[model samples]
Target: MNIKQADFVKSAVFERDYPEELEHFEFAFVGRSNVGKSSLINSITNRNKLAKTSKTPGRTQLINYFLVNKEFYFVDLPGYGFAKVPKEMKREWGQTMERYLASPRHKLVFVLLDIRRVPSGEDLDMLEWLDHYGTPFKIIFTKMDKLSNNEKFKALKAIKTKVDFHNDDVFFHSSLNNNGKDEILNYVEACLNGEVE
Candidate 1:
């Protein structure tokens, strides 16, 4: 997909506050804190600062919506787990995510995982929740540039020991090198075109 225009539309915390443009399908980006959601968004959109990137985890607190090509939205869902925030705030974040996931406007969810780390309990729980709700999702292993070719193989194998996913079922991305950017963008295009579910 050739991105002609990508702009920050709004930040929202509740369904009532979601952009009135529900006609546009929303592809939600969700994952644990510090998993590189913002960086990946910036990379895919070819915008350096479209989504804020931070070294600190949980920097993205609200649901940020970015309009891409004026056709759909790239929804940056709040990162979950290991944000160094209060327990109540974390719980509230989880609740907020649950409410958003139930919306029909949420067409697809990209569940990002750090390739260097084993999938956390929270990560597994997110997958289970999506399965239970029948939400269409794609797994993305980030930070691929941090690993060697052999290490990449081993890491993906280790992840499969827990998730039971096939090689083609997930994507490996690197914001640093822009790896897997084309495949992801193409997938998004297919999704919007009704070629992929």
Candidate 2:
């Protein structure tokens, strides 16, 4: 899982705009706005400014693609559930996300969740949609650095009670401290190597 090279490839706003050649597997990250998606991506790739990080929520409004080691892509889908945007814009975002998720090249999707809060209704809806579509995804609890050890335990327990996923399918991550970075990279490596489904 050594990242020898990583570069921003493009930003796509529609399904037809996606890379023409699907030569490599794709991993996508999706979550509500301001859930640390950009931070986690930058931390994992060891690139300070690869993915744009902003103080404002809903800054990522397009599907951004990053070429990793020239072998695969790390797709950053636009964050959902940002209410500040207009109704029509939100509708368009939802449609665009649905189109990308339907792509067959997506090997794995990391569904990010904020560890400090319970899963919102939008999050639950996403889980259900994934299930209906038979999309393979794993839940990632972000912002772990903000929680104490005991609090982390409690949060994990509460989340697990609500989600029908095994412990192996969940990861607790913190971009600030590089927590869960290695494990995630290893998982991605395994997937790329045909060792994981």
Backbone clash count for every predicted candidate, in the order shown: 0, 0
Number of the top-ranking candidate, with lDDT as the measure: 1
Please write out the lDDT profile of model 2 over residues 1-45, one tens digit for every residue: 789899999999877888865565688999999999999999999
Over all chains combined, what TM-score does candidate 2 have? 0.95
Model 1 misplacement above 4 A: 22-24
- Per-residue lDDT of candidate 1, residues 1-197 (tens digit): 88888999999888899987656467999999999999999999999999999999999988999999888899999999899999999988888888899886757999999999989999999999999999999999999899999998888889888898987888989999999999999999888777975
TM of each candidate vs. truth: 0.97, 0.95
lDDT of each: 0.91, 0.87
Cα lDDT of candidate 2 equals 0.87
Winner by TM-score: 1
**Which pairs of residues clash in candidate 2, taking residues 3 or more apart in a chain or in different chains?**
none
